[model samples]
Target: MKGLYLALAALLVAVNCEAKEPPTQVVYRFDDHRSLELKGWDCDGELWYTDTQKGIHSQVWSQFYRIFTKKFIHPSERYMAISSWGGGFTVSKDYGKTWSGAHYSPGENEPNGDNRPPYDDILSFTVVGDQGFLQTKHRLYMSSKPFDDPRILPGGPGIHYELEDGVKGDIQSGSAGWAWGLIYMTRQGLKGTIQELQTSWKDLPDKTPEVKGYTGWDHMRCDMDLGK
Candidate 1:
């Protein structure tokens, strides 16, 4: 009887230990010095993270972020990433018990995304199921990935008639899940031309007096460090 009681006590202790275990963490750093993290947490189809006080947190509305990324954590649910202090990010698949992977927000993720040039501090997004839009440091991209992972939008469809006969432009779309009218380095109050998705430079509009970049912008629900 004594041995049986000891076994029960041990089992209870083990369960308690598991319940109190801390969450995992993931962080990212960018050349632009914008960094962020993701702590595995969730709430109401949204991602929960740690704030300045280091307390667990979640967004008042994560659906808006769904337009871009699917990594939002739900309340009290097991997540693989979370946010951090001093405005950074982190990630961990094991729920904050441990963590790995970091990145700089609005950093370059080229040869894998759209034609718009690289930009920074992309923190706002909106997604609906498999269709959504993402606003990063430079510009917005489109995708149809799971709520946990979304892809970038492609360029418009057609040819640059002004160019050589056989030359072609990138595939751009206006679909909701894959439609992003705004782009990086675009001159405010002026419109720029869309070339191939692989080009690096853009011709400024005639009326604009030197285009400004990332002027007066902010976002939420992104890893911040690695998410951009």
Candidate 2:
């Protein structure tokens, strides 16, 4: 009888230990020093960021629509952008120090009119230095500053283009050319045009952005511990 009691007590202890395990946080690490930690993803999806090198840790966002959000870091590592199909876009230019966000409606006309592609028509969004490259089906756009208010660049369909990495390529609906902190895409490949196109370009320093830490599109129920 004593052995049976001991066995039941041991089983209860094991169950208690399993129940006390802490929840795992979903973290998106841009590098060894910086990361975005998601605490919750319900109505007020709690979002936080940490810069271990800077000794800064703070909440970034907690909006209603976070279930569909995904984060992206520019090659310059200065601009960290987040996109949610339902919540719009948010960008940080000061290495997660401050943030600006706006919601974009697809198929809707912008202030510039119809020829200009909608902000949400992000077939491929790439950043090189301080410039932002956004490519649609027929045109390649450029933002002198980027992730904020990008303007259309001079170009059309039917020409291939060369990337900064020396890889001559055509327009693709998926990823674009991201090399040496520059991106290029076109239907008909052209060489040296990326440099020839005159714009007030700035040489933003490279910090080697990374995106391998993203877990998935939406946060699972287990990702956050709602209980006290």
Which predicted model would earn the best lDDT?
2
**Residues 18-63, candidate 2, lDDT per residue (tens digit)?**
6763332554555567766655333235666678887767666764
Off by over 4 Å in 2: 1-24, 41-44, 65-73, 103-128, 131-142, 146-228
Which lDDT tens digits does candidate 1 get at residues 15-120? 9866763332323221132223333333113333333333434332232112223222122222232333222233433323444433332323343533343324
Q: Cα lDDT for residue 132, model 1?
A: 26
After superposing candidate 1 on the true structure, give the runs of residues whose Cα lies further than 4 Å from its correct spot. 21-228
- Clash totals in order: 55, 9
> Which consecutive 10 residues in model 1 have the weakest lDDT in total?
143-152
Q: Candidate 2: which pairs clash?
A: 159-187, 159-188, 159-189, 160-187, 160-188, 160-189, 160-190, 161-189, 171-186
Q: Model-by-model lDDT, in order?
A: 0.32, 0.45
lDDT for model 1 comes to: 0.32
RMSD of each: 14.9, 14.4
